[model samples]
Target: MLNNIGLPGLLLIAVVVLVLFGRGKISSLMGEVGKGITAFKKGVSDGSKDDEDEDKTLADGTAARDVTPEAETDQKKV
Candidate 1:
C-alpha cells in the first residue's frame, strides 16, 4: 500500500518532521553519526594488524611455533 508516495507526499512528511524537531537537533544527530563511522573504520584496521603479527612463520619454512605440552610428548615415548 506504500508504493504510491510520490514527490509531494515525501515533502509533506519532511515538513512534519522538521516542525516536530526543529533544525539544530537534527544537525547534531548527523554529526554524531559521522564520528561513529570513523571509529568503526579505525577499529577494523587495528584488528587486522594484530592478526598479521600473530601469523608470522619462520624464515626456514617451518611452522610459527610448537604448541604441544611437555606431558603429551612424554606420553608419546610409551
Candidate 2:
C-alpha cells in the first residue's frame, strides 16, 4: 500500500517539512529525537535491572517478613 506514494511523494513531504521548519531546526529536532530515544532505552534497561534485582531479592525468600498488627500501629505512631 505504501509503495504507491513512491519517491516523488516522499520528496514532496520532505520539502514541505524543510519549508516549515528550515534545515537547521529540523536537524536539531532530529538530534533531540535521537537523544530522547537513547535516554528512553537507557531508562528501560535500568528499570529492567532494578526489576531483576527485586526478583532476586524476592527469590532469597528471607526478604518477606510478616509484620504484626501491633508493629504496624507502633510504626504509624512514629
Candidate 3:
C-alpha cells in the first residue's frame, strides 16, 4: 500500500498534515524531536564511557578493583 506513495503523494500528505496542525505546532514538535535525538546520543556516549571505565584490568588480567571499603573493613575484623 505504502509503495504507491510517490513524491507527489508524500507532498500531499504533508500539506494535509500542515493544514491540520499549524506551522508553529509542527515546527515545535520537530524541535522537540531533535532535542530528544541529541539527548539519546549523549546518553549512549556516556554509557559507553562507563563501560570502558569498568573494563580496566590489573597486570594479572584480573579486574582492577571489585571490593568495597565496607567489605575491606569486615575482612579486617575477621
lDDT of 3 by residue, 1-78 (tens): 798999999999999999999999999999999999999999999999978866896557678865678978898899
Q: Per-residue lDDT tens digits of candidate 1, residues 1-78?
A: 889999999999989988898889878988899999999999999999877766775657566976899999899988
Give lDDT per model, in order: 0.87, 0.89, 0.91
Q: Candidate 2 — worst ten consecutive residues by lDDT sum?
A: 58-67
lDDT tens per residue, model 2, 1-78: 887998899999999999998999999999999999999999999999998778656665657555579878898899
Over 4 Å off, model 2: 1-3, 58-78
**Displacement of the residue 71 alpha carbon in candidate 3, Å:** 29
Q: Model 3 misses residue 73 by how many Å?
A: 32
Best by lDDT: 3
TM-score of 3: 0.73
If scored against the real structure, what TM-score would every candidate get? 0.60, 0.68, 0.73
In order, what is each prediction's RMSD in angstroms? 7.4, 9.1, 9.6
Collision count of model 1: 0
Show the colliding residue pairs in model 2. none
lDDT of 2 at 72: 88
Q: Comparing candidate 1 with candidate 3, which one achieves the higher lDDT?
A: 3
| Candidate 1, superposed: residue stretches over 4 Å from native | 57-78
